[model samples]
Target chain A: MAKQILSPLPGTFYRRPAPDQPVYKNEGDSVAVGDVIGLVEVMKSFNEVKSTEAGKIVKFHAENEDAVMAGQPLADLE
Target chain B: MPIKRLLIANRGEIAVRIIRAARELGIHTIQAHSTADVDSLAVKLADEAIAIGPPQAAKSYLNIPAIIDAAKKTQADAVHPGYGFLAENAEFADACAVAGLVFVGPSANAIRMMGDKVAAREAAMRAGVPTVPGSDGRVDDLETARRVIAETGFPIMIKAAAGGGGRGIRIAANPEEFDRLVPQAKAEALAAFGDGGLYLEKVIERARHIEVQILGDGHRAIHCFERECSLQRRRQKVWEEAPSISLPEAVRRKLCASAVALAEAVHYSGAGTLEYLYDDASGDFYFIEMNTRIQVEHPVTEFITGVDLVREMLKIAGGEKLRLKQSDIFMRGHAIEVRINAEDPAQNFMPAPGTVTELRVPGGNGVRFDTLLYQGYTIPPFYDSLLGKLIVWDEDRPAAIARLIRALHELQIGGVKTTRSLHLALAADPAVASAQFHTRWLEGWLESNATKLAAE
Candidate 1:
């Protein structure tokens, strides 16, 4: 079964903190529980969406600058 | 003066409605979209489109500087705030005036007067409009609250002085409940309205929520009848109808006339709604507050009156006099509106957002669907879950209800859950159909029917 990472609030999804900065995580990247995976900016505040389970990222379900809702699957991990 | 170009400073169905109206008047429209709404239907329909900022409304639609900059860059002469965001915001109206762009609503002073609940209540009292008996003003402490409760009697409602939309309120039936509820209500008021200022009011049982729509041209005003919005959940209106069935003809006239008097007292211009809580037992009504903008349920009034309220607002902002007199306004048919949200009713109204794989909207006769969705359009989950409003009009309430049922059945949206089933259930309910409900009726009905609804 794939472990899904969901958005905490409604906001724009950012694959990385800044446009030129390295992404916190990427497809095929290994991550542990509580590791930052991406950022969801809401109301000028950047919230880091952290991984709740240890896994390797299989897919990023949302694209950069895409609007995401609360509980939307942001990424798929295996 | 006709509006040469208009900028919609909000999003969703209201934006589409305004754009359609502007188009009919031969006025060009510019739509400001957040990053998430680049491909929205409103953008596609506008004469021009500009990306304001990111998805979060605070950075995009609600950001004064960004919205003003968009209007300036697009050279749009007027900004129409369609109901939400900065629609009723006084500061935004002031900013628009300073920028030399018409705000397309009430003056900033009128908005400020109605925005503050305490001040509005005081104003209503001074205007000889009946208000719910409560504390003199903002209660100072527990001692003051205790005294107020003693004087006002039990089963009183504690409310935030600056709050609206039913937020930051608590009902206490006795001393025990009052002690426990006051602190929580105060904290919520502080967090939501930025003011812990609290007031007390005797809770009116089985009160129907009715509001009168008034249009003004700075010098004079007239009433456009009343709308019954008693069917609500979480204090947010879910279904609304014109010509409330529960109110008597005399009461309705009085309520509407009182609303016009209040508007005239404030020299209110543009479109505004004076909300009231009406108790059927005593045929008594009390002023609640005023919504100083084009309301979400304006379509219902438009359906009955055949008046293009948005167009009238634009013309008024352009310094035009009232075209229609008081006697010219007449309610014809009964119109009902259901807010279709991208939410799962079975899952505690949880947001359900996804791509629209298929889309079908009802048409013909009195069926109308105002939406910004199309096939292949992804519903960005960043903002409100309101997909659109489904409104139907007919000669009577029963006919309107029948039409609504047919319309809901004909409407189809795929790849996301919606409130269609819930609305269907509510429409079929005897209480809703008979128009026998209060503000808390829907929430209670939803809770009790949750099990049966889930079984399906």
Candidate 2:
């Protein structure tokens, strides 16, 4: 079964920690629980979005710098 | 040419502020907004509204080309970059001129000059203003470093020339610490910014953040007086008061005059603020930097001076020479302003962005609530957390504080956590009441009163 990674915060989502940095996790990258998948910037404060269940990233639902809502699916895991 | 139509390239409370000022001046207002702010108060109040781009500020408010296109499409004769997004951007100022539209602030040259720390310091020195004594450029040699240290004395800061934002710096209280930290600071600077260069500056103790508000029309300039914004969190001022209570009458005259001198030297146009750090014990004030846009705390000065600063900016941009002289401006009484941000004081001021379910705005004589909040309005999560500024004025500082307290109590907003309670606690604080706080005072106060603030 496949699972979706939902953002717990409503804000702009960034795949990379910073503009100059690489994406935290690319498609096909293996993820573990507590691994920081991305960052959500809400009102100028950055909050790390970490995965809860360990799995492999199948695809990213949101692009870099996409405005997201609470519980919005950011990535899919299998 | 007088401005007939104006385009506001900003959002939130400031956009509303610009619209109000333009409306009073009989100028048609075209508010440029993001997709998230379509239903904002500013949009509804504006004579016209246009969408620039997406919700993110970079794609919207900060998008220069998009904003320029909007102005052109709307046939706006002037552009107002209300503080924050492209407010102090020299390129944006130049871009507006290139597009044959007037920018409602200083020239691009003035913004460029004051934007650089080194150039601004030099400008202050040339205008005979006292600046914080520091090493004249990089202290690359041991002899120069020793001489600079001797001049600056004990309790000095060894800062990296290329470093900023409170990084790559170390404070040495004495000679022993200086000796131990110099090499370490050099190594850190080199590792962080690829530069081993360093400088030294005198660490002013008990420094209070004082700034003079000045207006100009490219020739003459006048000051509205100084504002004290020492109460800060993470270098962001949360509360502000005009006519600094700490400055003696003589010191106040000198501080405000120096700012006017600097403004006139540059032939500055529109409203600008020159920031300074004052040490009351020594009765010494030093120029720090200049903000070339109307600041968030501007309302405090407005209350004390009875001047419409935004209106003045519009008039100046419309090719009018300054209508008022230095003698025409006078400080009436004490005024205070507290920022009401969409933040939960209980959660360490964590930003809370949601719909404003219910709203009860405070109203009375000498109390003003400049906000974008309307019933059922949702504050977007993409921008800063500042929802409004609650300003109050009275006969004196104590009276003003009392009014602030009363106003804070009467104010109410629901469905989103606000910083009103924290401001209430600050109003009641003994140090704040007596105006005995400094720039570093609020962070400590927040830590000590965290439980109490949360419980409230």
Candidate 3:
């Protein structure tokens, strides 16, 4: 079974915590529930997107710094 | 070369305002919009629309490169940044210049000069404008801050050196408070503006926030008179009125002249406002700062002076010099403007962005509703909460207040919480009715009457 982690807000999605930092969860990276996957930048503020289901990250749906709408999938976990 | 076609690098009512002004001037308009604003009123009404970038302002409205690229692609001769976003950005003006497009504002040099509050204060002082007693320049260390506070006395204003729009300000009443507030103010300033530099100024109690509207064409400038913007909520103006009723004739003239002097000193062009903190106790006014863009409350000045400021801005940008001499302009009547924000006042003024299910705008004599909202239009949640501005004009302040009350009663909106009812309550309040309120009055009034206003 696969689960999709959806963005909780509409804004620019950043894979890294900071520009210089590496991606929070990379491709094929193992993830746990309550893990910070990425950040959604909106109105100069960043909201962390966390995985709700424990699984291994299969792939990211949105590219780094890509603008994403609310409920848009951020990554796939299988 | 004149501006034959204009690219509006903004959104909402201001973009619509620019488009209409350009249309009246016989110039075509290209509205630059984000994906979220594709169906906006400005985009639909424009002669052409271009998708600049994504929904986020950083990638769209504030994306200078994309905006200039859009202007070039649309063959726009000029770009009009209608307030906020990139309006006062010196780099945007420079980019427009580099791209061979008129920026429809003051020179990049002027923007740079006024963008920094400390530098602007220096400019005002050079122009012989009275400024609030404070540190001579940016306070470099805690020692300097302490010394300035001591010299200026207690209850001082600790302000960010490179701040505007009411952010990065903290008041300190005593030595302990001053010591506690300086680092916090500096830290907040550093976070907000990337500059921890601070300045100190003596806080004038019960001061009135007044500003004068000035139009310049690089040759000379003239004042359109003054506006009383004292009624503010947390330093943000909620209501503004032109030809401040409380100002004496002498003080008013001096204030307007000082504004003109400041504008002339900068060789400022287009519509700009010079804000002042007027102390009624001493019958003196101190220059606060200059806004290098058309203000949200400009309509009140237009109503009182009968000057279409936007039209004048276009004309000035089109290589025409300002034709209105100082003697030619005259104040006609009283005018008031109330900002209608899409925020629930009772909910800590939280933004209530949503689709407008219905909008019954007020009409009749001297009533104008400047808005971009329409039925079924979904207001994106990524911008300022200002849904519209309700302005009214009449023979006097009392009449204007009466008319404004009637207009507020008639105006209707749905599907989102607004400051409409709050404005109604304020308008009906005796302090507001008598034009007797200061910048901090509204916050105090809300503290006492928020529940009552919400219940009503």
B60-165: candidate 3 lDDT, tens digit per residue? 9999999999999999999999999999999999999999999999999999889889999999999999999999999888788777876789899999987888
Off by over 4 Å in 3: A1-78
Least accurate 10 contiguous residues by lDDT in model 3 chain B: B447-456
lDDT of 1 by residue, B102-167 (tens): 899989999988888888999999889999988877887998888887778989998888787677
Local distance difference test values of all predictions, in order:
0.88, 0.91, 0.90
Per-residue lDDT of candidate 2, residues A1-78 (tens digit):
589899988999999987768999999999999999999999999999999889999999999999999999999999
**Candidate 1, residues A14-53: lDDT per residue as tens digits?**
9887776798887999999999988886533477898888
For residues B1-456, could you state the per-residue lDDT of candidate 2 as single tens digits?
999999999999999999999999999999999999999999999999999999999899999999999999999999999998899888999999999999999999999887655567778999999988987666787688789877888888887765543457698988889889999999888876676878777888779999999999999999999999999898788999998999999999999999999999998999999999999889999987789999999999999989999999999999999999888899998999999999999998899999999999998989999999999998899999999999999999999999999999899898999999999999999999898888888998998999778723
Q: How far out, in Å, is residue B454 in model 1?
A: 4.6
- Give the C-alpha interface root-mean-square deviation per candidate: 5.3, 0.5, 3.2
Best of the two (2, 3) by lDDT: 2
Query: In angstroms, how far off is B136's CA in candidate 3?
Result: 0.7
Q: Residue B124 in model 3: shift from native, Å?
A: 1.2
